[model samples]
Target chain A: MAKQFNQLAYTNLDDFVYGSCPNPVTTKSGMVIGGGMVYPEINFTLPGMDINDVTMPKAATIYSNIIEGVLKRAAELYAPGVLIEFETLPDFTEHPKYGIEVNRILLNGMKEASEKYGLKTAIRTTPNDLREFSRPPVMRSGKYWETMLELYEQCARDGSDFFSIESTGGKEIHDSALVKADIRLAIFALGILGCNDMEFLWKHLVDLSNANSCFAAGDSACGFANTAMVLAEKGFIPHVFAAVIRVAAVPRALVAFEQGAVGPSKDCAYEGPYLKAITGSPISMEGKTAAGAHLSPIGNIAAAVADTWSNESIQQVKLLSEMAPVVAMEQLIYDCRLMNAATLNGQQLMFRDLLVQSDSALDVQAYVLRPDVVMRISAELVKTQDNFLRTKLAAQLTVAELKKAIVEGKVKSDKRDMKWLDKMEKAIETIPDDPNEFYNEMKSVLDMDKFIPSEYGL
Target chain B: MATLNDVSQCVLDGDLDGIKVLVQALIDDGTDPIVIINDGLIAGMNIVAPLFKSGEMFVPEVMESADTMNEGMKLVKPLITDEDIPSKGKIIIGTVNGDLHDIGKNLLVMMMESRGYTVIDLGVDVKEEAFSAAVKEHKPNIVGMSSLLTTTMMKIESTIKQLVADGLRNQVKIIIGGAPVTQEFADDVGADGYSDDASTAVELCDRMMSDQSSSEALSA
Candidate 1:
């Protein structure tokens, strides 16, 4: 059975700061993830590099070198500790045999670099979700699902310290809901389908971690909320709508912890602050530093309460004087150093407050990410044990706050944006608190042809 | 006693159940199906598209309006002959192989369908052979491809190549869209058109269809 958080771990926002978790997991490399100063989680990708389908030798060499170069840069910068995340491109993990070999080589590089530089190092292996190998993706069982499990098992056996995945559980429906901005459907996708998939997927992931003595860090709503944020950034969707979806995704992401994921949730899950408040799990957050990966309104404010500050992911391409990943390492070390300095000076709270105030009122999306705002919505969220109710309550609280902020002129808004607020509020009100009724109504009203209920065990 | 205006209001409100009732009422009251479709359902959707572009309307609202119009379409469509159906063009669309991302593609589908283009959605991770087969079977006026991954986006070029090899490339106009897709890339790959957003994709299709019709008129 997984550990479940039924109440807020830290009632006072002041009690909740970066670099600490109530239950921090210590890695085998003797690096502490939480309960200390903030560390940089370096995530980098192949620079427009494609993995060949036939052989592993060339891909393995290229990837292993990237790892060595990043770790070497970290050592030269005198960075205290680092968690290097290898987020596999789909082609990497589509075939488990080649994927396992690639992972082994990358882990070898991390080990060598750590021994050479005396730097505290750990590795997070995030396998790409290949469940989309089939249309109307079968989440619970299939050859694709089996391949995902095989990659995780072998990666753990190969000495991966942390296991994470940006799992695509309810993405089929969630994608449609996002484009349509259907709050009711978004709730069903996130609360019903997404929560169910998390419990099922994480149960096995947590079990694998326990058997291999690895840490099952957590999942991210990177595909869901982050997609909404990007669309909002492009002016394709309203920022207010993205803000509401961000809060709505919290309870769904919290399901991962409910199923036993520990501290330091994935980067790009901008909903980290709310999950941090509720689960007290140290979360990895990327902000201004993550601009190379994606842009958003919550850049500075996203770092306000991050336990692990990260540059979401940079390509291994070169800048003028140095490689891009190396440049990112210098930037991240300086960022974590500043954050760690504040913690050491006993002025972390003052720094945290400054971070929040800088961007919270600038964009509606940023307003919801404020630590105080995360706390208020999270407080009401924990009142219910049901994931669906928690999702609804979170959305309700966030919508109320956003409306008040718009009226008070704290966050800029267009008069037309009010219709969205009203529509969202009305939609939330109409959803029956009963999950079963909501599910059935969604079945009737939604484009059910695009969804497979059996996959979610409905 | 329901008027066509009542059907339009239901679509504007995105009241799915109300749209069903109002559309059925008009059918029972002896209204012409095409008039109800054009003046009522599509008319409401026409207003929604601009509002969406102007930020006065949001995605979900526009989606609801699309769903509402679609529901009304289902009721009125059966009453008309295939030749009488108003269509801007037919489109075969999908996210190219190795890329499962389709939120953008699905939005484009909705927008295209709302604009009276008959879009046959092939869904995500669609292989090159599948696109060739779809073009052969559907004989669509235009083919659309989408890819959200830089890794999988190369599949678009390969898929277009397959279309050319299969002798179907010149038969249909080819367009592409997605996050990483650019007009420069599209041109490099020999695509006829590219769009960054769903609304603009619809407009591109409109322009492509018009140009195609104009060329045919000149040939005749």
Candidate 2:
């Protein structure tokens, strides 16, 4: 079982600043994520590698070239410390050996880069979650789960400095709710199903990481909130709804830290700020720099509270001057350099406030990410012991804040969009505080055919 | 007793239980089942389609409304035979090979179904052979593919190639969507249409079906 968070990680919001966490994780290569200054975590993808072409040799060559290009550029730019994340293609992990071999390749590149350039570096190996390989994917206890565990173990043993995954525990439910814009079901997915999966999965990963002496870096809500973020970006859903769902996702991601994963949460998890506020975990966040991977509304504001700023993920394709990953590294290094300079000059808080002020009022998505807002929402979040109630309180508080911001003319929003806020507030108000009661009510209401309760051990 | 307007309101409110009660009440009041469907259920969705496109109603509200309509339909659909009902068209859709992401595809499915199309959902990571097989089996008016990953989007071309290889290319119009998918990519891959969002995808399907019928009429 995971440890329950009964209180906020810190007392004073004003002093709850970025560039550090309660449990800072130092990697095998002496790369510290939350020790003091913010570092760049560069995530890169294979350049258009087809699923059929993901053999061991091809993965090795492709990853080597990509990392060499990124690190070589980092060396040229005189980057102090960098973190490279290898998020596996599903095929690489479907065959666990290939996944392990690829991890070894990535680690070797990081080692060589550190030795050759006299630079400090670490590698985060994130195995692709393949439980979704089954249609109406069995979320737990299947061949896919077994192989996923095997890959994690081997990768950790292979000297992966950090362990992370974009786990899809409740994605089957969350995806359905997201498309429907059903916040009630979305809460059920994130607060209940997702929390259960995180506890179960993270417990094992933490154990494995401990056994192998690696950092159990936190998981991402990539399957949940990121999906909503992208859908909102495409105008498939309202930004207000996506913004509220982002806050609702905090409890689920928080389960990772409760299960003993330390710091530097996954770069793709935008819920990192709330988790950082609640659990004091070092969080890797991506924003404007991640436009190479995906476009988002909270570009500048996302960098406000990050311990490790990342470029999300860039492909290894070539640009006019350099490879895309190399270009991404140069951009990220400069961003980190500026941020570190601010910290060195005793102006980190001023820089953080500037980042927060830049984008917070422009959009509701950006507004909720403001450090003050994160702390405010997270304070209410820790008031509840139930995950369902935590999710509801998160949504209710965010809606209330957005409404307040709109009324104050701080955050501009259309009048018609107010109906959604009202509707969500009304819906959240009707939810029971007890998780069991809420679960029962949801079971009676939601379309159970869309997901398997058995998979979540419901 | 509930009026047809009340039934429509139930859908608009996404009152699933209310819709069931209202639909049953209308049936008990001897309301014509077809009138209830066209005027009550679909009429509500018609309002939703525009509101959704206009961004007044979001995807969840729209889907809730659609699900309410489905719930209401369950009560009335049994009273009639297949020929008595109207379907917009048949659509075969799936996420392309090597891509398991289907929230977008599922939204398109729901939107298409709510608009009265018969949708055959092949689910995610669908291979080219499966797509061609679905087309051959269902003889759909349109084929839609979704790919959220840049890497897996390349599979859309291969899937289209398989359709052409199977000599099924001319039978149905092809459409593609997803974040990374674009109009140029669709044209490059020989897809007949592209839409960025689910509502637009529904509109694209309607336009393509209309165009196909018009072309067939001219040929005839």
Candidate 3:
């Protein structure tokens, strides 16, 4: 299980989760990659067709062509990963059968391009109304799940590396709690069937934080930050960080970097200034902030470079190479820190800006050792043996250590002293029995203390 | 003899087994199938729909109630011969060409069916000609179109334009909807109605049909 949790061993899983590569880039000159995470807009207009006589295949061809163009261009650019998110118009005729056909065509096209270029890809189906139990009828009817399982099984059989099922908006269905349960069920079912290839993907860490804002607000960004913290603490690697550096930084370095871009969008409302306040910086500048400032510049640089590739095709390749390592490291370090923090806190640790107060400028080599520094600091804090320090440190440790301590009574606290233990237990129950449960249990136990109570006093 | 109140009580209690027995009793007692449907099953749905909209009842409860209603409908539907099935209006619904998504479409069909609309679903990837052919054959009062893909959304307009060119545009009202179908898009396509969900589709279709029937009566 510990070996499986290692990122290096992730690709070996039968069903692996998919994530976008960091540092989307352009080639030196020629190509343009404009569409970011959103699905690229396509011209839906059919040429030379009388409305009454327009054929299904002809209409489908337009979409097929657009997808082909994008994938071909991505292959040429040599992108390590790309995400395809689904959204649709609410026409009654657009039933499951039609959706399947569309998905089939796109998947086929993606497969063809992936085979040709060895490009990694991720797919995100759109959010359906979980409150209504209304999914795209295909999905609601269970056929979609069956189809997905089959597709995954075949992919596993074919030695295709990564795939994932993601729900959007943290809505009822996409709720982390619900998704965790569903993933467990999927894994158990798949495992029982002897189809060991199954993986759950987590993307858009920033988005998840944003959606869980009310919970975060209640806990002073604790709930918002806790999901990532818990996942990391549990030794579960998040599939994608989705602007993690931006989530924790002062003034959110990503926003400033994006603001510097050609068409800069506003910083997400929930973050922006509030995050800046927490991080103790008025505005984050490039190379100034610890996290996003260092990484966002790379993404900006990659985007710029990718834009110049030969017709966006070669640009993707350049972007992937540049971004892959950064993304991998960002995810790895963030998860590791989260695990450490949660275990030490003896509760889910709230995400906070890791402010390293250095007396002087440090080289990249010095900064690379920050993880060890954090682990050391955490260990010292725990040994203080003060109740508060012990409590805090218990919440801060990695899941493995936290679980061991809890079981061994190394971190002693009475039932009353640890009110969060119950909540943590419930959260742990949500995960399936994947030997990963040990870590998840630790995460859940730690998170309870981070949750702000509804009232000032019990 | 089971009365509408009896059926309503059964629904309220979520007694699918009891509802089934009561419905059978209603049929044996010679109550008109349509009367039982309207007064018993539909009445119960009408009672629950508001609760669902108001958040008084969550999804699971509504689904269970709908399931019960569907069970009752199954029994009543067979008793009602083809001639007895009341048609609020005839509708030809399909996903636009190239877009093959149907969850939204299915929901709309279920809601519309519950409300007594006779719908001919052309399924996904329906071409313009097929839509026109269905319209011509069914002489539907309205055409409801759905699309899930932005890429395939434009097919709705093309289909409408084709209907107009074939001199069938004035004969029927077109309603368009889906995740991306905005009111402005519906207007641009010369569609009479646009709605976001299956529940809304039912309401919109009812209003459209009522207006058409009233205008026809006024002309007469």
Candidate 4:
């Protein structure tokens, strides 16, 4: 089944400059083979050789050592065909005197390491307005693009197999639109540079292309999932790309990656599915742990699909490889999506559904539909939400009624009717009869003031 | 006799052009620059600060208003001169080691500068020794360290530890901030203050300085 799926979905993998395998590789222990890339430690030092400052040399040396260590680790742990990515430190342009030199030294060191270790590298250039690294002649308008291209050329010259270009510096310049344009421009610019070692360059270019194209949508979560599905559909699922997919399915993978439990690239794709599953739901161990565990299954499926189709459609595999890094780099895209979904759903549950009870009977229907909100509201009402609601609704009700509700704990309801009262009575019987505790817990969940019209000018 | 209410309303409406015109008219009519700034501009900023904290405005809008306030300050700064520059207090601020991002730090600098404090900006990726040097050289009332990345935030602890080792920890209160930085982290590092945004940084500085003065007075 996996082989057949690969044959149908990935006919273009063979045309890639790199080889592809659609089927999963199984080891002697019967475990599937998967791979990922880890981001190196943040190098804070300015990169340069001629800077007279004592810190410059130390920074350069530290950066170089980090790259060397990463390369050595990658070689020791993975097979030669396995892909590893090293994200070059962003240039610090605020301190121009040493910033330019520091970036140069860092890039030069990275290039040397790539050559020696046969590693792939990606460079995120300083935003163009920043005083770091002189603007290249080709980039009179998009100066940052030219600077990044120069770094790509250097990487190419130094035997780097891949390059990922991202625009993340310059306060005025690094908007979402500009970032997308920059990535597209970098792709065309790199293509025009006439250095066509297709396998290496295409893989990196595909990653940026996926990231840029998806980010253009302006919804981080949707963009993340959309990018992963798009890349997978396109057969750009390299080992590192697969890692990104895994991260999309599991967000804790990010914490794990940061903690060095899993390689950075390994969990790249896990965040999306993990977030989608948990959106608007109680953060059950089922969602968090189950979503995390699901990565292994998807990873296996993706690997099987890749391995079986490796020989038949190298071109498609190559395309997949090219586009996969974007999945890895933008795991936060899924996180943003989950947050937006949660906020939207929570609003709907609270405002449009929860308050519209038909009778004195508590309408468990809405609560049933949104059990997470029910639990959240139940817990919050006992703590903070009731006070807020009480204060907000106090003006609408009779002062006598309001005081009785506060003191004697029996209040008439106009909105919920008699059915709600019966339901409340039944609910009270099943739980602690302490209305104050229940009201406080409910209060803890709802900030009724946020829903109310403000007293001041709009 | 214009109250803070009128000035605050003017700021909320983003009537910078009107503010400038009104301020210039006040100056022309012989109103003191310090009084106009304190009663009008600073009063206006105090309102804007809470708005910013509440997410009523984002970074760009805050920065734009800060820029407007800066222009107004430029007109007033020259009028005051060296002798007239009131000493609210001195602060040394920088992004901690291994973090180059400084948009928050820069905003805090501009906001602090507007509030009449002497600010020594140590710049990004600042080392512990450099911070120690600045503290020793300037003898500032407070030292502020910022880190935007979780990885770089670890440096703040070492920097504070270094300050303690150098015997300068007790001399200057420490304040920490940035995107990833938390008050819990600040407490862990023994920092005297933590602010999530630039306006809050100014408020914290004001409170910290006043507290220091009161403590000194009690000791004396």
Isolated chain A: TM-score per model?
0.97, 0.97, 0.28, 0.27
Error (Å) of candidate 2 at residue B114 is: 3.4
lDDT of 4 by residue, B53-156 (tens): 66554343455556556555666677786767565789999998766566568778866875668899998779899999999999999999998655467789
User: What digit string (tens of lDDT, one per residue) describes model 2 on residues B1-220?
Assistant: 6888888888888999999999998898888999999999988888889888877777777888998999999999899897777788999999998888888788889889888898999988999999999999999999999998777888999999999999999999999998778899899999999998888999999998888889889999
Judging by TM-score, tell me the better candidate of 2 and 3. 2
- Give a tens-digit lDDT track for model 4, residues A1-458: 00000012122322110011122222212222221111211112222222236656766565555445434443443322222223333333323334444445545655664667754433322212221222111112244444544544443443333232222111122121111212211111111111111112223333442333210000011123223333222222212222222222122211211111111121222231122122211010111111211222232112111111110000001124332222221222232233224334544222212222221122111111122222222222223222223112211122222223324433232332233223323332332234334334444433343221111000
Docking tier of model 3: it is incorrect
lDDT of 1 by residue, A1-458 (tens): 35666788896779787787676777778777777688888888765434576435766766787788888999998988888888888877778877788778778887898789988878788898888567777788888888888999999999998888888888888887777777888888899998888889889999998899888888889999999999888777778889999999998888888888885799888888888899888899999988888998988898888888888888777789787887888888998999889989998999888888999888999999888888888888888889889888888888899999999998877666688889899999999999999988887766767668888888
How do the residues A34-96 of candidate 2 rate in per-residue lDDT, one tens digit apiece? 887788999887765465543446757878898888888899998888988888878767878
Docking class of 2: medium
TM-score of every model versus the real structure: 0.91, 0.91, 0.43, 0.42
Residues B48-98, candidate 3: write the lDDT tens digits: 665655545433344556668778878988876887866788988888876
RMSD each, Å: 3.1, 3.2, 18.3, 20.3
Off by over 4 Å in 3: A1-458, B9-14, B58-61
In the range A201-266, model 3's lDDT, one tens digit per residue, is: 121222232233200010011112223332222222121111121122111111222112111111
Question: CA lDDT of A204 in candidate 2?
Answer: 88
Which stretch of 10 consecutive residues in model 1 chain A shows the poorest summed lDDT? A47-56
- Give each prediction's DockQ, rounded to 2 decimals: 0.41, 0.49, 0.02, 0.06
lDDT of 1 at B159: 96
